[model samples]
Target: MKKVSCIFIVDDDPITVFGIKKMLKSVASCDDIQIFQNGHEAHEAIKERLKEGKIIPEVVFLDINMPIMDGWEFLDELIALDIKEHITINMITSSIDPLDYKKWNGFKNRCPYTLNFKNKPIFKIEANDLGCMDIAS
Candidate 1:
């Protein structure tokens, strides 16, 4: 598999962000790894990039729960935009609620390019739930 050039980590937790970043670095070769503290920031950046006719991130590791614009909200707004290219949206979250899966499935239906969401129990050197090598590759 080919490596991703650009990746976006959209999460509010600093610890989670750091863990993901480290895992990605160890497992794959990504030239640009951008971090967004919340979905709103990530959403804005995506829109800006689209407007400027710049290349969007190839992959997005999104967290479900967040303040000032959750993952669902971001996806809702995103689907409205004219994004023709494919983007692998990985909903990396700790929540195991049934509703989360249900909601995610709906988004999956709407988003043809998005991958199934992953609920990670832990992020570490030995990847399991955070399949950085597979995802990045």
Candidate 2:
């Protein structure tokens, strides 16, 4: 699999975070994995990295409903930042609301980089598939 420099898991659910982390370990070669409990924290961290001219995480697993700031809010804030790098945001969620899919479709079109949608507890195969996410870039 292609190596990744960094990854971020933005979710408030501990169990989901744990599961995703473990799955990622088995499927990818990323060495840096940062976990954020809320979108507010994640956004702030990203800002700090950008200020330092550091590479923003190449991949982010974002959940829709989180305290302090939801996934949509985080995405909005992130896209507004002056980032020059490519980011792959995987919308991992348990919400089955049809509205979420509609929202995702709209968001996907609006996103500047790769944006994918998936259910909670991402599978190993899907995680492994991320190796090719940067191919076109």
Candidate 3:
């Protein structure tokens, strides 16, 4: 039951962010949750934190399509920064487009740290969804 110090959720949709934050509280006690409307703003915030030598989020949920900068572009910027290691990032977009899935899968293959693709309402904080992994005391 380790608490996540910070959780960064980057999506253009406000409602989606609200739902995800609400669900997260049930799993781990997050000290702070930063919600950004677009990839650019999210990326900027991350960089700012890094500059201040602050602890980054334990998890980041990114959306695919967005204004100013999309998820793909943010990934490129991230790599260009020679990001050796960072928190686990999961694509949480609702896009069912084949191309989007293909890109996501490829990235997963390249960077296994980039975890599973979870559609909306499938936040990783569910206990029942833990299935066999849920050990019985």
Candidate 4:
């Protein structure tokens, strides 16, 4: 599998972020890892990077519920930006609501880049299964 260059974890929960980061560090060979507490911050930073012609993350782990902007809103803004790079997005949330799943499925249909829906507290196995690990290793 291709090695991921950069990754972004966009979630409000500090504990979740820490756990995900730890898991990724153990399993993946990504070069850069960025953390954002909310979608608004992530969105602004991404836009700034785009404007500056800087490297954007190849993968994004986004949570559904946040203070400034929610995951769905983030997706809307992201798609509207028309970013040229192919960034895979995984919806990582604790929401077990059927409606959330439905919405995520709908978003996946609309945006092919949205890869999978993962629950909170991502595991090493799941990360590896998602092709996030270094296959050459």
Quick one: best lDDT, which candidate?
A: 2
TM-score sort, best first:
2, 4, 1, 3
- TM per candidate comes to 0.84, 0.90, 0.82, 0.87
What are the RMSD figures for all models against the true structure?
A: 3.5, 2.3, 3.7, 2.8
lDDT of 2: 0.84
Per-residue CA lDDT of candidate 4, range 51-127, in tens?
99889888888899999899999998999898877787888888899999999888888884646788765665254
In candidate 4, stretches whose alpha carbon ends up further than 4 angstroms from where it belongs are 125-137
The per-residue C-alpha lDDT of model 2 at residue 41 equals: 95
Distance from true position, residue 3, model 2, in Å? 1.1
User: What lDDT does each candidate get?
Assistant: 0.78, 0.84, 0.72, 0.81
Give lDDT tens digits, candidate 3, residues 1-137: 54667778889888888878778777767778899888899888878887898876667778878999998887776655555554667777777788988887777776635455777666456432212124422
Tell me, by TM-score, which candidate is best: 2
| 63 Cα displacement, candidate 3 (Å) | 1.0
TM-score of candidate 4 relative to the true fold: 0.87
Per-candidate count of clashing residue pairs (backbone under 3 Å): 0, 0, 0, 0
> Cα lDDT for residue 37, model 3?
87
